[model samples]
Target: MEQNYLAPAETMQIHELLNFKTICMTSSKMMEGVVFDQELKTLFEKDVRQSITAINDLQVLLGKAPKLR
Candidate 1:
């Protein structure tokens, strides 16, 4: 199977995205604990789940990046 490698720039972008998603997920999880409204809490939970999925996808793409010496 042929593998497509990511350019250095793309790799960096994915890293940044992973960091951002992680921050967002963490904040949402923290907020869920303090939120009084069930609807808002549910929304936060949904965001966290979606962030996890996105982070997984980004990691897969990052794996394709060439190793830097």
Candidate 2:
């Protein structure tokens, strides 16, 4: 049976994965514009897309994050 809510440990793991994926996506996006080689730029674009997909999936598992207020 699948649980609707993640366990605390699992939630933490998902949170960390989300953070890592976001960093990777941001870095790839930053490099894509400045990159001189066409192939390298394409590679960065692919990475950025993949990272975004992963981040979205992880966020789904994490549910709504907390607000400071």
Candidate 3:
């Protein structure tokens, strides 16, 4: 037995984009050398670094944070 189903082109395109995201996540997790296909990696890295630096700065400003209070 066989069944046929059809989807519109826009729907197909959205599905493909979702699949691509899944593939990227799988590859990044399973492969050490796999690279991301988007230009945002550099931006993300910079943002992460900046966030770390800010945390460090705040740590110094508060003299080891309010938790030590």
Candidate 4:
């Protein structure tokens, strides 16, 4: 993968995405504690997995640091 350095705007956007992803992932995890229904718990777990994937992808982008126009 081409690891381009992130421009200032791109870096800021990535920072925002990272923060959002963190909140989403953390909320999903915390929800597991209160969720009693199996189906809902499963849903929460799925969301957590998705959030993790998204965060991972975002992290990769952050590492690559694309300067998208």
Number of clashes recorded per candidate: 0, 0, 0, 0
Q: Kindly indicate the candidate among 1 and 4 with the higher lDDT.
A: 1
- lDDT (tens digit, per residue) of candidate 1 on 1-69: 987999988999999999999999999999999999999999999999999999999999989999878
Error of 1 at 12 (Å): 0.4
Candidate 1 residue runs with Cα over 4 Å from true position: none
Q: Which is the better candidate, 2 or 3, if ranked by lDDT?
A: 2
TM-score of each: 0.93, 0.83, 0.38, 0.81
Rate residue 61 of model 4 by lDDT.
Answer: 79
Q: Which residue pairs show collisions in model 3?
A: none
Best-to-worst order by TM-score is 1, 2, 4, 3
How much RMSD separates candidate 3 from the native structure?
Answer: 20.6
lDDT of each: 0.96, 0.84, 0.47, 0.88
What's the residue-level lDDT of 29 in candidate 3?
Answer: 45
Highest TM-score: give the candidate number. 1
The residue ranges of model 2 lying beyond 4 angstroms of the native Cα positions read 1-3, 64-69
Flag the better candidate by TM-score, 2 or 4: 2
lDDT of 2 by residue, 2-58 (tens): 546566777788888889899999999999989999999999999999998998888
